[model samples]
Structures are given as structure tokens and as C-alpha cells.
Target: MKPAPFDYHSPRTPEEAVGLLAELGEDAKAIAGGQSLVPMLALRLAVFEHLVDLGRVSGLRGIERRGDAVWVGASTTQTAILRSPDLAAAVPLLTRATPLIGHFQIRNRGTVGGSLAHADPAAEYPAVALALDARLEALSPRGARTLPAAGFFTGMWTTGLAEDEILTGVSFPVRGERSGHAVEEFARRGGDFAIAGAAVAVDLDGAGLIRRCGIALFGVGATPLRASAAEASVLGVKAADVDAAELGATALAEPASVPSDLHASGDYRRHIGAIMVTRAWRRALREALDA
Candidate 1:
């Protein structure tokens, strides 16, 4: 079925988009790539009386290095991320994860902000954002406010974005020297959504000891989850000696947190999650040590 009949408004600027959302209130939905929302609308899983299109909003589309972090406009497409040399150099994890997203056709039209705002636990971008401590920027009638990645995702297909707020951009910090990042996931097919995945970043000290670590898991929880227990356990330890298998187990230590579905049992998903985490951890460790 087609989406419910709705009035469409194309906004050329972010201010106009925010104003439209504010005025339209509960009935309005802001759309960029529409890769996720359109399918939901088509299935009648979501309905909005008014659609605010941000395709013409130029302000929310670009990539640049601002100070020590990389600022990616909310409208930046996954295709753009794959093609940006600077982004790859500054945040290699993003490029490494891009291929694991849907096929090139979907990536061509899928915006980073759309994926994050939709907040599907199985998506790659959200987990990568979490692993990198990305900061999300939003605009509202109340002005601008930044949300940390840790708190940005609230639940399945939900986020901290208010009804009247529009996500403007995101900031991913560059940890600079001695840092390595890797992404590993299990999927039924090349472009299918991951059944379980892990994005890992490791920072090593001069003596090859772990300085910091970030591990984010997807497809095993309502929202993308950070492997805090595993992260804390490996800190300050010799990077090479940290057992990837044990680290993976620690990441999924809370078996109850993993969800079961027709595709895979919770126990099975947790087991796959552990393997993904282990592979990612080992790759990240190698890169960090070599750096």
C-alpha cells in the first residue's frame, strides 16, 4: 500500500525545515534520503499527515575537519562517505563499515542522519557512531543542542530527537595517533542487515599497552549497545595479550540483554556477536600496535 495521503513541503534551508516541523507538530515528519522511512510508510507502519522534505536543504550536506573531529552533515550519503578520502583518513571505521550496509543503490540514497534517526539496532552507522563517540547536532525552536552518541539512541526505531527537532549534523572525534579501528559483522548475504556485529577502536601507548578502547555492538539489542564491560577490562593492558575471545565474552556477558527472534536465537546471536567482537578486536589491536 502507498503511504497515507499527506501534504509534502520541500524546504530549501534547515531553518525552514525546523519551522515546518515545529508548526506541523505531531503530524509532521522530516525526510532526507527516505531509504528507511519510505518503506515504513509504504507498509503503513508509520503515518504522517505532512512530510517535510530536506533534500533541498544545502546546509545539512558536507564533510569537513573541524578542529580535531570530523563534522559530517546530516544529509551526507553513505556513498559520499565511501568516496571521501579525508573521511577515510580521519575516520577509517566509517569507510570500513560502509560496504557492510545495504547494496550500493541503497547507500546512494541513504543519509547518515536518516539511519541514525531511524536508530535501527542492526544498522552499521549507529554502532560506528557510538564506537567513535560521535556527537549529534540538532536544531529546534529552542535553538541548537548537541547530543552525545551514548544517549542519542533511546530504543528500537527511536531516538532522543524531539518532535520539533531536526538533526543538523554529527561530529566524530579523531583520536589521532596510535589508534586503530575495525568493523566485523555476520549477515545472511552480502548486503543484508547484520545478524550481529561489532565496531571496535583501539588506542595503544608507546609501550604497546592499551590506552583506550571503544566497542559497540549492533543487531543484538533494542538499541545499539556499547561494550562497556569489555572496554573497561582491557584498558591499560598489553594490547597483544588481551584475549579477543574473552573480550568478546565480556562484551556479551549479559546474556539476558541479547534478544531472540525467528532469524536467530538469543544464545546464537550472542555467540555470533562474540565472534564478531573477537575478530574486530584482533584487527583493531593489530592496527593500533602497528601505528
Candidate 2:
């Protein structure tokens, strides 16, 4: 298969990229890593009259700290995130989850913003973003705006980004020394999309009680599912006394929400979702205790 014929524009800056996007309107698509979009193009799943390449957009690539949050340019590669000591120290959940994205080769070419924009339900980045309460920055001809991770993902392979907008970067809050993180996922192979995955971050008080917790599950719903109910159930509880099974059950209380696909049944996905959540929660609790 081959991509449909299209005009290609290589932009040197984000403004230019967005400008091209705005000018092209619904006929154009902005590409960063092209890991996901390229396949879509080849299969004709997505077609456009123009392709706006942002690879040369310098402003859209880097990792830096702003106030209490770390801003990662949309073009930052998964491999870069995996090797960034600053990112690992500031947001360990991201570091823990990056390797599970695909294979080493895939991660080498996959961009953070590309994954977020692609919004794959089984993707590690989306669940990590939701768990960390990250913010996505979008640029358009109308100007710029920030979107909370919670509302950014609207459905499977879908997002709130307007057709004329380009994701420029993402911001993640710095986790303090008292916080711990872990990622748990189940996949058939090393690079396969997760059947069920969970990303967890926990902050502990001096007394070893869970002061705060963030839990996000992927491959279980239309979008990354934040287990607020499960998180609430463990607050003020001793980390050592937390119940994985109970928390897992709480996270998937509505079994109907789990999707049934060729890989697994709804009941099985719900079960796997619970198991992943439990493992992530317990591992995070241990890290918090050790911290």
C-alpha cells in the first residue's frame, strides 16, 4: 500500500506549522514522528491533500522545567524521554512507562505529542499523562491554549484537538521525593499493545498513609480511564494494608464499560484491568514507603 498523493510542507517553526494547518484546513494533517500517521496514510485510513511536517520545528522539541512542572516539547521522542535523567527524576511514571510503548525501534521514532494526538486506547503515554495530571499545549491560528489530560482524550483514536490546531508540548507536575510511581501492563508480546495497562503515582505522608494517589488504566475503555473511585478508597490507609483485589474491583465496578474485542472478552478485560491496577498500586505503595 502507498499513501495518496499530497503536497508536503516542512515548517521550521510551530507558528509556520500551525499557519499551514490553518491554511490547509481540513485538507491537511500535521505530522511530527509520523510513527502512527504514516501507517494510516499508507493504508488510506487517513487521507489529506497536504502533509505539514513539523520535524524541523525547533520550538517543538526539548525538555525543560517551568515553575513546578516539566514541559516536554511535542516532538520529543520516546527514546529521549526514556533516557532523560531529568524527566526520570521529575516524573518517574513516565520513565517507567516509556519502555512499554512498543519496541526499541518504535520508541526511537515515536514522538510524545504524536502518541497523545493519536490517542490510542492501549498507548502508555495517554494513561501516564492522565495519571500525572499533565496538560497538553495546543497552537492554532486563533492562538494558543492548554488542555487538561482528563478532557483531552475524548474517545478511541480521538482527541479534542481541533483540525487547525497543532499540539506543541505537554506539561507534567514534578513529583516530590515523597511520591512513588509504577507501571503495570499485560501484552502478548514485548511490543504488542497492552491488553490492559495501569500507571500509578502515589504520595505518602510521614506516617506512611497515602496522602494522594493517581491511577490511570488503558486498553479498558474508549479512552484512558482514571480510577478515581479506586484512588479514593485508599486515601488515609496504611500502604502496607492496602488491598489490591478490592481496589481492582473498585476500579472496574462497572464491568459493562470494558470493551470486548478479538483479543479478549469484556469480563476478561475487566479482570485484567483490575489485576494491572492492583499491581501498579501495590508497587507504587512500596516505592512511596521506601522513599
Candidate 3:
């Protein structure tokens, strides 16, 4: 399927990109790596009169460390994050899930900001971002505004981005020395979209008691959700003392409404989500204790 005819503008700067989006308004769409948007355009799922290409935008394609947070440009590809030793050391959870994305070729072109803006509930990046309490930065005709990961996804394939807004980058809080990150997913085959998945990050005190824990689940909800109940269950407990099965059950407290497709039922997803949550919890505990 060929995309509908449209005017393409390759902007050299983010400011120019922003200006283009503002000027074109509702008829314009931003293209980063085109991993997601191109497919939609081909299928006519998305029809735009103008396409603003962000590939030539210079400053939107790198990584930087700012105090306690790591800022990743919206155009930074998944392949880049996977191989970045700096990102791995700064946020291991993201690195752990990078391999779970589409495939080597797709990851080579899929941009981090693009994924977040697309907000696919089952995508690996969204769950990891939620687990890390990342902040999304958007630029719009009205100016810049920062949004918390929790408030970013409003529904399936939806986000808080305004019509004239462009996501510039995302900032993930640095995990401290006592922190640990882990991820796990169940897919029909390698590189397939997960049937269920979980990402966990933990910060422990000197006494080995959990100081903070974040758990995010995917593939069972309209939006990736933080396993608040499960996280609460682990707080103040030593990593070795956590009960994985119990945490899993707690994580399923408010099961996200699942779509019943030919592949799996809502009940099946709930069960798988629970299992993935338990596995991720156990893995995070192991990493936390260096066991």
C-alpha cells in the first residue's frame, strides 16, 4: 500500500520543525525514523497533508547526562540505546528491554521519542519509561511543557501530545548504587510483540530493605500501568524477603481492559501478566542483592 500524496519537508532544526508543525496545524505530522508512522500512512490509518521530517534535525539525536537524569533525544534509535554503554550503566532496565523491540532492523530505525509518542500499550519502551518515572518533554506553539510518564498515556495508541506539539526528548531518573533493573516478556516467538511483559526497578537502603520499587506491566491493559499494589508490597522489605507470587497477585489488582483478539483472551492475558510480574519481581530482587 502506498501512502497518500503529501508534501514532505525535511527540517534542519527542531525549532524549524516546531514552526512547521504549528503552521501546518492539524494537517501536519512529524516523522522521526518512520518506523511507526510510515506503516500507518501506507495503510491509510493516518492521512496527513504535510509530513515534517525530523531526521535532519541536528540536536535531536543524542544522549546527555544532566545531574540525576539522563536525557535522550526523541530521534535516538533503539539500536543506539541497546549498544550505548553509558545508557546501560545509567538505566539498565531500558537496555534490558531494548532487545525485546521488533527486531534488529526495526530497532535500528525506531526512535525512542517516537515510541513514547506512539504510546502502544504493549511496547517495551512505554513500560520501561513508566517504571523509571521518566519525564517527556514536548515543544509546541504554546511553548514547552513537561509531563510525567504516569500522566502521559491516556489510552491505547493515545498520548497527551497536543495537535501542534512535537516531542523533543525524554529524561529518565538515574538509578542509584543500590538500584537494580530487570525485564521479562512472553511472546509467541523471538522479536514478536509480547503477549505479556513486565519491567521492574528497585532502590534499596544500606540495610537491604527496599527504599523504592517501581513495576510496570504491558500487553494486558489499554495503557501500560504501574503495578502500584505490587510495588507497595515490596517496600521496606529486604530483597531476599519479597514474596514473588504474592506480589504477582497484588499486581493484578486492577487488570487493564484487554482486547479479545484471535490470539489471546482477556483472562489469558491477566494470567500471563501476573506470571510476568512475578518473574520480573524475582529478577529485580536478584539484581538488587547481586545474587
Measured by lDDT, the strongest candidate is 1
What digit string (tens of lDDT, one per residue) describes model 3 on residues 1-291? Answer: 999999999989777888999899899998888888999999999999999998888888788999999999999999999999999999889989999998899999999999998888889999999999999998887788999999899998899998778888899998888888889889999988888889999988999999999999998888898988778877898777788887887887667466667778888888888899888888877787872
Give lDDT tens digits, candidate 2, residues 174-206.
997788899999998998999998999999998
Q: Please give each candidate's TM-score.
A: 0.98, 0.97, 0.96
Q: Candidate 2: deviation at residue 24, Å?
A: 0.9
lDDT of each: 0.92, 0.90, 0.88
Candidate 3 colliding pairs = none
Sum up the clashes in candidate 1. 0
21-121 per-residue lDDT for model 1 (tens digits): 99999999998899999999999999999999988897899999999999999999999999999999999998899989889999999999999999999
